[model samples]
Target: MNFDLFWLFRSLPAVILGLTIHELAHAYTAFKLGDMTAKNEGRLTLNPLKHIDPLGFILIVIAGFGWAKPVSFNPEHLKNKHRDEILISLAGPISNFALAFFLLLCARGLFVLPYFHYTATGIEIINLLVSWAVINFGLFFFNLIPIPPLDGSHIYTTFLQKTNPRLFQLVYTYGTWGLLLIILIQVNTKIQILPIMPLIKAITNYCITLLHFT
Candidate 1:
């Protein structure tokens, strides 16, 4: 593990922002759908400390995988249960993609200057925006995996009505077992079945292209 202080310091801000906003979107959308649990807990804000999942954040820096403290929601509070659940569950990953798109636009539009002055620091700005874009892209793709306790699992439950819910129920019940199994498999397999690295690279390349990189 290359534990360089400088790299960690630079990566810190974007990781914090990425995790915070992704969770905030979950809270906000759920609240709008009539769940006030997250709001009552004061999780609707952008404070990274509130959303930081310590182990998850650490893994994010070390292995590029991270998650935040999940925002609570009372599904019973929603008027339209099915539609509302789908929307709320979809909000988290969707928000990360939105963030990626916004970062890509800013990187391409405002930072790259073939016009009005400031050519010297363009590389710095490009790096920052590219970093921001990659972080969000990773979050977006990773969270969309349909595994137990992930946002994508919630999404799948909402959408895939025909699947054996009991199977996922078992996964949720034995969540610690499931997590341990996942980690062990990841270590031994040496090939991630659902690796998001390719998707992350694709998003980065798209960003570079948007910024007119040849």
Candidate 2:
């Protein structure tokens, strides 16, 4: 199995930043909603080490997508358990979208610098900015996949729990395993059951167009 270590190296900053902010958003949102579990557990900090999972980080380096340690929160402390949980889960992905937009805006501003194209450092900065923006965009979309343990699952459950109990239970029961199986299949077969890559590509392309990045 050959992997491009240099590509991974370049992507490291984006991965760390994206994952760190994602978890922090969850922790912060939970705290805002009266759940101090994540805050008390020392997960409210912006430190990447506190949020990153070793296996997840390694997978990101080798594969282009992975998750971070989920911020733990107690629903009992929340004002409205179901609604708050959905809010907390939604925070992570929304934070990624915000980060992506900010990064792309910065990249756009940087690209307009008079000597940006001529200087090696400026070019590198632009590349990193674009890379970071795209990575965050991908993360934002990936987390929205409605599978168990993913933020989307909470969203689906929140809206459907009252309307469709049986379906929610079925997905909750087998979602994680199904997600893993799909990941494995995608890695080995290069066929996507979920089309995550295409979605990511579309997002990146949109960002590029929006930023007018040459």
Q: Whose TM-score is greatest here?
A: 2
Q: TM per model?
A: 0.82, 0.90
lDDT of 2: 0.86
- What does candidate 2's lDDT look like per residue over 1-214, in tens digits? 3478887878888889999999999999999999888989899898899999999888777766578998999888989988899999999999999999899889889889898856999989988898888888888988988888799889768767768999878877788878878777776676878876788788888878877877
Weakest 10 consecutive residues, lDDT, candidate 1? 111-120
The C-alpha lDDT values of all candidates are 0.76, 0.86
Candidate 1, residues 94-172, lDDT tens digits: the string is 9988888888887777654575226656777767777878878888887777775777777666544436777656766
Question: What would the C-alpha RMSD of candidate 1 be, to one decimal place?
Answer: 3.2
The C-alpha stretches of model 2 lying farther than 4 A from their native spots are 159-170
Candidate 1 — what's its lDDT? 0.76
